[model samples]
Target chain A: MSTDTPANSESALSPEEVAELRSRVDELETELSTLRTEMDDDSKKMVIIATKGTLDMAYPPLILASTAAAFGYDVTVFHTFWGLEILHEENSKDLKLSSVGNPNLPVPNAIAALPGMDRMTTRMMRGKIEDNDVASVEELVRTSLDSGVDLQACQMTIDLLGYDEDDFYEGVTTGVGAASAFQEMVDADIQLLV
Target chain B: MSTETTETLDVKGQNCPMPVIKTKGAFDELADGETLEVVATDAGSVSDIAGWADSTDGAELLDQTEASEDGETVYKHYIRKAE
Candidate 1:
């Protein structure tokens, strides 16, 4: 008896062997595709909610949201109450410089004696933030918008405060109520009230 | 039962969201079937880290321990990587 292998012999490979090899390749391809899709989805799923406003309270939320977005999270800053003032394009100008008797303002007494305190405080805060290697509230807002983070203002507060839509900075999404804001928070993987 | 492997991430002194952000990044870098241990000094991190882990499916939190360090409370989380 002679034992020899032929190059053109299709029968050399049994039908089961061919089928198993093809199935394994198909399975591997499916798994690879699924993994790629999952990673892509994970990258897109990062979400954050930030609330900004009120003297010292204004910076944390905005800064955190912006930095989070910079780290690739889809972020949203919900500006309500005193927080809405930070969204005003002319917040440093038209807004009052006095913290005295401002119920919403944090550290109201601490800023009460500084002349032209509101403006001076804003500038000083901006400088200090820069000095600390942190982004300014305005820059953070801008960066948040640029990074595709939602910048939502509170509509009810806007109406209550008599602020027109035009008073807000560019790229801000029009006012949304608390219910809507809560819905947003619910969808977010991370939410901050600062 | 075999002993499970673990990874650690130190995010002390960082503020809110940073610890969460870094933890997420560490999770992303981990291989499937691994676990991550995160230590953070931020007060908010206790809730934030737990919330993040719970929101995602497959991820398992093995442990969460709080300890006082130099007058500040620190949170330590042990999370298993889920596919």
Candidate 2:
């Protein structure tokens, strides 16, 4: 059961045979370490910036973060400026896709600004998203957090906007300055601006 | 599909990341060299699970397949622990 019990204990191996086996072990170890290094290099780390606050913009960063995390990548999403709205506990619930300036819409700017136009447009967009099975912002964030994606709030923005830490969702790991978040992103293998 | 597994996980009706998240959790319960069988209903898991197992340091993907279950398709992935 022990390594000391040799494969052929009944007879001793010649010195040359022992030397050959030792060399073989050394070669295997080197090959294994090389493979290990290759694997390490291929493992991707993702850092994404969620800079836009609209419902349409919110889905991309959260979706990609969850997807990358599911691929066993270390993922982080940093929220700053208006993008922090997606992370806000109360505002997130009312997040809506804006139809303003959407080139795809056939309506002219004047019609687009009609009193009830925003609400109708938002409802239409929301319906399309649901019908298409696109992941909702809340669902995506849940998946991202459950997949171990770190959500960070930019402290400078939070202070400038006079928001408290508790204003964000439950899983915000850090409230850091923009520079700190960028530093983290710089070290990551993948960087995305959303 | 061809590999034998010591444990099996069913993540039916889940979407995208849940399958991989649950699979990773199952892998934690396995000892080195043991295989885990993960079954998921999410279409995205086909690539997600494979990529996760490949990129993970000590994870090995032994086998992968798809089969229909109750008129819907499901993905089955077998993984082996390496470290």
> Which numbered prediction scores highest in DockQ against the true structure?
2
Model 2: residues with Cα > 4 Å off, grouped in runs: A1-44, A104-112, A124-135
lDDT agreement of model 2 with the native:
0.82
lDDT of 2 by residue, A1-194 (tens): 68877678658888999999999999999999998987788657889888888877887788778767756788989998988888887887678766568878767877887787777887888888776555667777776787798988888888888989998879876458778777987779999888
**What is the lDDT for B60 in model 1?**
73
Best prediction by lDDT: 2
TM-score of chain B of 2: 0.93
What DockQ does predicted model 2 obtain? 0.20
Clash count per candidate: 1, 0
Colliding residue pairs in candidate 1? A53-A83
